[model samples]
Target chain A: MPPAALSVHLSIGQAYAWSVFKPPLESALGLSGTQSALPFQLGIVMLGLSAAFGGTLVERNGPRWAMTVALICFSSGFLLSSLGAATEQYWLIVLGYGFVGGIGLGIGYISPVSTLIKWFPDRPGMATGIAIMGFGGGALIASPWSAQMLESFGSDSSGIALAFLVHGLSYAVFMLLGVLLVRVPRSEKPVESAPSAFEGPQVSARNAVRTPQFWCLWVVLCMNVTAGIGILEKAAPMITDFFKGTSTPVSVSAAAGFVALLSAANMAGRIGWSSTSDLIGRKNIYRLYLGVGAVMYGLIALFGDSSKPLFILCALVILSFYGGGFATVPAYLKDLFGTYQVGAIHGRLLTAWSTAGVLGPLIVNWIADRQEEAGKSGSALYGLSFVIMIGLLVVGFVANELVRPVDVRHHIPAPREAADVGARQQPESA
Target chain B: MSEHDSSQSPPDRRPLIALAWVWVGAPLAYGLYELVQKATQLFTG
Candidate 1:
């Protein structure tokens, strides 16, 4: 019942690999990059929905059943997408990948998180980071492999269909690792010799929504994600557009590599950055994420067209932070709310992600499309979008600042038998 | 829990802040440079 490998596998197969299908899907459907990003957006939306609605189910059924359901939904989504691609039906791709698969993502994403925290109560931040790191890292492996398959299969409808079939079968096997391995801990005891200073305020799912803290964190996540994905979804075109008026141009193959590199950065951020949350505390770290992240975006907004190296460097840093924001947020929530219902609370909070999924791309793409129509070339079109991202990050920073310790009134008391928990702690203090 | 000093210390914040910066800075810089490089290549080439 060990939760480690299974969590990683499901994390990679379900969340990250879906992005691998974006390019081929776009090519086969003759859709633009923005249009192609729709599936990822929809899938992210579903991630929030499933997590919100299914957290209770996950708690009741345990990770085994939740992950099993995730495997089925996730794999079937690929199968269905395969069929859709073979038939040249774009809507099927939406339904299969975005809707059903997204549900799997939502469920699978949270399944291991709370369980890991329970198992490693002493290191809750690091534990959740270990599992969630897979979600970020998943894209790293999937993107290159997908690109290779597409190269071999020819980027046609049939090739794309085969890729989906392969993805379904492979992920089904991969996610099974988590389903088989994850185990709940036997004890509910706290791990620290002394309780963490920040541990007392246990907020329920219901109360969490009402607090200013929750809304602030929500804004922080939404803006962070929006900024990162806005660029991610449009990575290829945005890059290509940057130099349309210049003398040098990027080849399609190189653009694909650029995407791959971003995926690597995203993956690395999940593990490399988030685990650090255990030491620094989530709140202070987020200040940097929002504050410095906004500055990075501003640098790009102000001077991007003039200096290509500066632009790329700043974007990479921003995206790394973006990925780190995701990997670290669960730990942040754990800091604010005790582990009692962290998964459910996390699920509810994912609504921020769903909101960002839609708004980020809409802002970036719509503006870029308009600029293209207006005959704006080079980096001129992205000025407004980057500026908007800065504004959003500023809002998020304000929200993070608004976070405070949850009021004790918000805590739902435990059962009578557990009433002595307060007494046990009081005597220990004496 | 309420009796303990929950306020995070500078020692605690320093490492985490450093890690957060690495996470935030590395990817932000990398993604931007990569995108810009591609964009520039698109036009100049």
Candidate 2:
């Protein structure tokens, strides 16, 4: 299951590596940075939308069926992009990669999550962690690989088209392994997974939205992702900006290095911190991600340009919390909603990610633009944004504190004793 | 194979398990290697 899950995630995880195509596309297509950014942005929006809308279908069809659809949509998106590149029709690329491919991203991201949790009921956090870590690391594989392709293929339209062709076909082949390999539990219900003290009733995706707990987690995930992604989107520039007037001014290569290091932290955190959640529990892990994560932001804001290592260390920790936040959420959902309809519920929860995807970059870029207009330079450019991120994290922390077990009213009839416990305990607790 | 035995242990799946891990691990390692080469510039530069 882990390998099969990785086959799916690692392939679709290439979304993060889309930046490698930007400069080449800009040169080839005469695009602005903002224009080049459109497809990736739209892809993220579609990721959230598709996941929210498609979650129920995926649950109904099963992982094999889901993987097949993902393979087709994702691969065809690339093939279409290849044709778009060949014709130099930028809108075709957007439609292919953004609209069509984004559906693949959304479906593929959630495909293995519920199944892994169901299989590894005893360590749901670790199970989901192993799968999701691939999503974080996908860029590491694709970024350099894509760059090498561009280098070898000459960055022309034909070259870009060829690259897209290879990505489409190879990923299609890789994802098929997952389609062939994955299997659901032999038992009708996955063994009653109650790994933590804050276990909630087994709730269907339909009933989950009515409970305050779901919304609280929504806020929690939204704020956590928002804080982390803000730094991530601007990492290279942010590092360079910090030491703009310093003696040890950061070179562009060094800043790129900083970005890579942060990516590593993000990937490692997905596996390391999430697996840790299995022992420490999900809510407690989130307390670390949100509570301490805010402090890391405060540290970056306060200690500006004083020590390069300190700034890098703080940023890396925050990014790890970001990745950990993503990896751990599925288990967190399972803890609150149970295995029933968790995939669907998780899909709904990803709407928060789509929201944060827009929200995080907007806050950072808007504030920076304003500050730049006002002649603010150095860390001053990001001071207000950091403060806002810290505030958002605080808000998320409060929401996490407000999380309680789901009310029994939302629960599906449990297959075992776990059902009786929820039924009897504080029936209208919400 | 008995259901109890299948439930308790699948004794002969080690080679397939290792192969699966290697399949994913090799590419991941290559990616990590490239990333490390890039990341080293942060300190060394």
Worst 10 residues of 1 chain A by lDDT: A421-430
Over A165-222, each residue of candidate 1 has an lDDT whose tens digit, in order, gives 9988987866665654444533334334444322455666777788777788888899
Error of 1 at A175 (Å): 1.6
* Local lDDT at A353 for model 1: 84
lDDT digits (tens) for residues B4-38 of candidate 1: 22233347646744554453344335434544454
**Model 2, span A122-150: residue lDDT tens:** 78888888889999878899999999988
Whole-model Cα lDDT per candidate? 0.71, 0.86
Residue A166 CA displacement from its true place in model 2, Å: 0.8
For candidate 2, the per-residue lDDT at A300 reads 93
The candidate that wins on DockQ is 2
Off by over 4 Å in 1: A1-41, A80-94, A147-163, A188-199, A243-254, A415-430, B1-45
After superposition, candidate 2 runs with Cα above 4 Å error:
A188-200, A414-430, B1-9
